[model samples]
Target: MRNSRIPFVKYLIELLIVAFGVFLGIMISTYQNNNRTEKNIKKSIGFIHRELKSNSQKLDKAIAYHYKLKSSFDSIKKELPSDLAMENYYTQQAFRHNKVPHWTGLGMASMDNIAFESAKISGIFQEMDIEEVQAISRAYSYFDSYTKFSENLMEKLLAIDSNSKVADIIVIFEVLGSDIIITEQRVKEEIDKINSQLENINK
Candidate 1:
C-alpha cells in the first residue's frame, strides 16, 4: 500500500511541473509581443510626426504665395478703368506677360499623406487610442478637402478662354483667391490642433 501511494504522489508532482512550465511560456510570449507592439507604435508615431511637420512647412509657403497673388489681383482691380474697352486693355497690360497668370502659375498646397495612408494600411490605428486616431483622421480630411478644391479651381481656370475680358478674368481670380485663402486658413487650424495633440501624446 505504501509503495503504491509513492508512485501516485510522483505522478501528481510531474503534472504540476508541466502546468507551471506552460504558464511561464505564455507569460514570456506575452511580454515579448507587448514589447514589439510598443516599438511599432513608436515607429509609426515618428513617421507621422515628420510628415506633419513637412506638410506644415508646405502650407506656410502656399499661404505666402497666395497672399501675394491676391494682393496683386487687388491692386489690378483698384486701378481698372471704368470704360469696358479701356478696362479690357488695362487688364491685358496687367497680365501682358501671361494671360491666365494666376491659374497658370498658381501656388498649390500639395500636401502629402503617404505616412497616414501607410499607417491605415498596416492596421496601426487599431493599436492607437481612439482620440488620437480621430485627430489624425480629421487633419487628413482637411488635406483631402483642400486637394479637391484646388483641382476644381484648376479645371475652372483651364476652361476660361484666352480672349476672355480682363474684367471677367479679374473677377474669377478675386473670388477663387478669396476661397483659397479661407480654405488654407481652415487647414492651418487643423494642423495646429493635430500638432497640439501630438505634443500631448509625446509627453
Candidate 2:
C-alpha cells in the first residue's frame, strides 16, 4: 500500500508543474503584445499631429488669400456703373487691361486627411480614449465641410458667363466673398481647438 501511494503522488506533482509552465508562457506573451500595441498607438498619434499642423498652415494661407480677394472684389464693384450696358463695357476694358480678378483666382484649401484616414482604416481609433477619438473626429468633419464649401463656390464661379455685366459679376462675387469670410472664421476657430487639443495630448 505504501509503494502504490508514492507513485500516485509523483504523477500529481508532474501535472502541477506542467500547469505552472503554461501560465508563465501566457503571461509573457500578453506583456509583449501590450508593449507593441502601445508603441503603435504613439507612432500613429505622431503622424496625425504632423498632418494637422500641415493642414493648419494651409488654412492660414487660404484665409489670407480670401481676405485679399474679398477686398479687391469690393473695390472693383464700387468703381463700376449700375447700368448693365455701361457695366459690360467697363468689364471688357477691365479684363483687357488686367484690372479684373479672374474667377479662378480664389485659393482652395485642399486639406490633408490621409494620415487620419489611414489610422481609422487600421482600427487605431479603437485603442484610443473615447474623448480623444471624438475630438479628432470633430476636427476632420470641419475639414470636410470646408472642402465641400470651397468646391461648391468654385463651381458657381466657373459657371458665370464671360460676357456678364460688371455689376452682376460683382454682386455674385460679393455674396460669395461673404460666405468665404464666414467659413474662414469658423476654420480659424477649429484650428485653435486643434492646437489646444494637441498641446494637451503632448503634455
Q: Which candidate leads in TM-score?
A: 1
lDDT of model 1 at position 141:
88
Q: Return the top candidate by lDDT.
A: 1
TM-score, predicted candidate 1 vs. hidden true structure: 0.85
Estimate, for each residue in 1-203, the C-alpha lDDT of model 2 and write its tens digit.
Answer: 99999989999999889998899999999998888877777777777878887888787887777677777766776665556434563446653213556434667678899989998998989988898888788888888898898887667666666665555555556655787767867876886687578667855
How far residue 59's Cα lies from its native spot in candidate 1, in Å, is 0.7
Worst 10 residues of 1 by lDDT: 95-104
TM-score to native of every candidate shown: 0.85, 0.82
Q: lDDT for every model?
A: 0.76, 0.73
**Superposing every Cα of model 2 onto the true structure, what RMSD results?**
3.2
**Candidate 1 residue-wise lDDT, 1-203, digit = tens:** 99999989999999999999999999999999889887877788778877887888888888887887777766765665665533543345645414433534667789889989999999888988998889889888889999998897777656666566655555557755688888888898788779777776865
